[model samples]
Target: MSDLWLFSFMDDELREKIKIQSEQTKAVVYSKRTCLRHNFLIATSKSYTENSILAYVDNTEMRSAVKDIQVYHMGTDILVKWQINEVPCKSDTFRVQLLDYKYQQFAETQAKDTSTVLFNNTSPEGIYHVRISWDVYSTVRNLYTHAVGLENVNHGVPAVPHVTDLGNARARVRWTTNPHCTPDLIHVHFREPSSIGLLKVIPGTDETTVITGMKQCIQYAIQLGFSYTTGKEYLSDPAYMTFLSDGTFHNAPKLSFDQNGSLLVQWLLRPGCIVNQTVVTVETNDQPAKEYNVTGDQPLARLNDLEPCAFHTVYVTIQYKNGNVERTNSSEIHSFTKEIGLTKIKTYIVDDVLLAHWESTQNCQALGYRVDLMNPTTGQTKAYLTGEMKYRVSIGECVKSCQLLVSAISVDTMVPVTTLIDVRPERVPAQPRPPFVRRDGPALFVWWTEPNLDLTIQSYKLFVNDSKKMIRDFEVKQPRRSILLNNIEENVVYSLNLRAINESGESQPSLSVQYKWNG
Candidate 1:
């Protein structure tokens, strides 16, 4: 057995006892070794090896702490680099933790490489502490590095801004910040084209802003700047824009009614202005206001089913891009009226004259009543104008039927009422003149003349009485002047009387005439 180094300080007797126990158990002894030296002690047996002595001496120290830790701000990302005295093993890994200004760890990551990049776009502009740690031989090693201060880091100006001209004296400006840098303050400058006194400044942390109350169709100079908490400001490139105001394009619309009673409204748009939608408002007395939406390209609009004889007012508004609004002028009040027909129409005939009467029941302004007498058979019409409700027209004796139309006419519209009347002469023809009688062998001839043809006489009736006071009647269908009377007694005195007949019945008989008949 080799000398036991642990018991080397003991007496020879104790050492000899330890050696005897070691030899009896078939055990091998190991000696102490330094960290720089390699000492090997191996014990092997096929059987009864329960007394084997195994020892170890620990000389390895904890891996040297990471040195020369460095951090850099690369645009939108932060880069961390470190150096170590020894190469890392395959199982070794670095754990990086980020602490905010409050010393609170907000993020941690594991990496096998010595260098890493940290993306901190969402973090605010402030100092951050980074801690790097590793495990070596069951011992923990850690180091820390701080982000560069805001004063030492260089920042560029904000990106060039985009300007949108929203009509109605308004504009929108938008920009983006550099991903590598953070700004504590944002300032916007606006300069009018014509006036130096119109310069304005707006300060905020947002990247977009809206400016209002600008002149119409004028050019403006705009610029943006980014500043740090250290009161250092960097300005971006200047930008130019022109904002258009719709005030000059707004005008009153023309109002009128079409033939079909639809209200038509028309308006004009300002030059060089683009509109997305047009809004029309219609208002009437004792009614709710009506709204209508139409495309901006169309300048005309029509409204139907409006109340008659009512006043209405109209106005228009236009909507442009970016929610800009323009209000136009309102139209004058307009009155609408419609024509209503006449009522209570009546017609009568008396003494060969036709009379027509009607009543105006509608609330309409009329100039006068026009009466038209029409002969349907002859296709002839005659008109008469009168202010009164009743009209009288003479009809000749030969008229059979007639139509009367009474119309109420106004400056704007006209309404007519019609009626028909029978104008045929109902009286019998005048009594025929005194009939002449002539004697013939066993025959007598009689003839008569009509006074006028105005009466529609269907037939004529003649009454004859002999000398003995006996009466006999005869009829003639024609108005011929001569009629033959046969089968009369010879040399007998006869009295003849004539009467005219028509649809209205017979007329009075003519005077009796005495005649002698010879056969």
Candidate 2:
């Protein structure tokens, strides 16, 4: 008959013990063990229990633990693989989870036979944590947890190295890699005249690697090596480094006009980058572009005899000994040259507005013109800027005689080229002829004629008085020569007068006429 028996296991290294019960004629026990040196198993019958060391069978295989983990970067995705040293049993299950920088799980999945898991859309700039767990004999056990970033994993190809020419048969190379990479060693390889040469450098705060003893004005091949933390060495694609300068200029060329209105070109060069020659170009709307070549030592060039008041664009370019050419960024400038004085300027009066116009005799390409009208009597001036040929201002009765100045202005240069003018109305309407009066029904009529046609007559003024003071007044617009007087009393004496009006002022009153109203 089979009897119930008790089995116990003890880990001497960890000093931990566990017990299980079984009922069988031939007792067998698989006790879990930790990674330690010594472990003992004890079996007991109904009467007594026996203690002995587990010598033949290894129980540590049943205990699951994370062994090796490999992480790879795939752009915005991360791939993780966890490998276990021991063969997995049919009942083994695996769980994979992706966590954020704060250890919050965003995605999770479980499988029975998968060692690799992929998380997509995890941008390269993000910090992510990965967790893996497996079931060992119905017990959940965590395998590994790791933090991944761009600097941590050799996800893709390493960044390309940048080489700069430092002149005098010397060159400088610079590059950067993932910060967490912690490369075992950095190697720079080049083929020398007789054999292959390698330079070993340690990655740290220093970023620049300088290589000397190279031929000037020649090209050479270069390669870099990096050893991953997993003890695997990686080599980068071959890159070319040349000692000849490539006309690398950091600052754009500056273009300006001198005090004498001449075109001046100025530029600057980086400390180590040298060029064989520089070319300056000038272009205009009415003419083709012109180029000027200057030696590399000369930083400035002057161009004289440019068209007056012309719009021009100037730019600079540099060339290397190897025929490589490069233009400076934002090196071009567009501007207008200074202008000459305006000519054939004339001023006149139209109603209440003062009209001033000029002739573009010099064909100046100016942005516009400025007209200024100053009242000498009141000491007040009004200014106007316009692109048209003519400018107008209201003078009316406020300004009888004023001074005018017309100027040509360039948008690039605010300097004015002006011509002075004295503004005065050519003539005012002459005095009107003597007036006559007529009676029709109960109203009296007063009439007059304008004797001068040389000046424009704005209106006609009529005045009536009853022997002592003015009684009624009327203003008749142009083309009307008569006005009718109402409310006439019987047998009363009245005096009538008329005047002509123009832009200048009212003309002297016409000789008075005597009249009488009879009922």
RMSD of each: 22.4, 18.0
For model 2, the superposed segments whose C-alpha errors exceed 4 Å read: 1-58, 61-70, 74-156, 161-174, 188-198, 203-208, 213-225, 229-279, 283-307, 311-313, 328-519
What's the lDDT for candidate 1?
0.62
lDDT of each residue in 279-327, candidate 1, tens digit only = 8898887799888888647789988756555678889887764345666
Q: Where does candidate 1 clash, by residue pair?
A: 75-180, 76-180
lDDT of 2 by residue, 57-129 (tens): 3333454455466566644555666666564332246677777777777778775666666666664446766
lDDT of 2 at 164: 74
Q: Candidate 2: global Cα-lDDT?
A: 0.63
Off by over 4 Å in 1: 1-247, 258-261, 321-323, 336-519
Candidate 2 residue pairs in backbone clash:
151-178
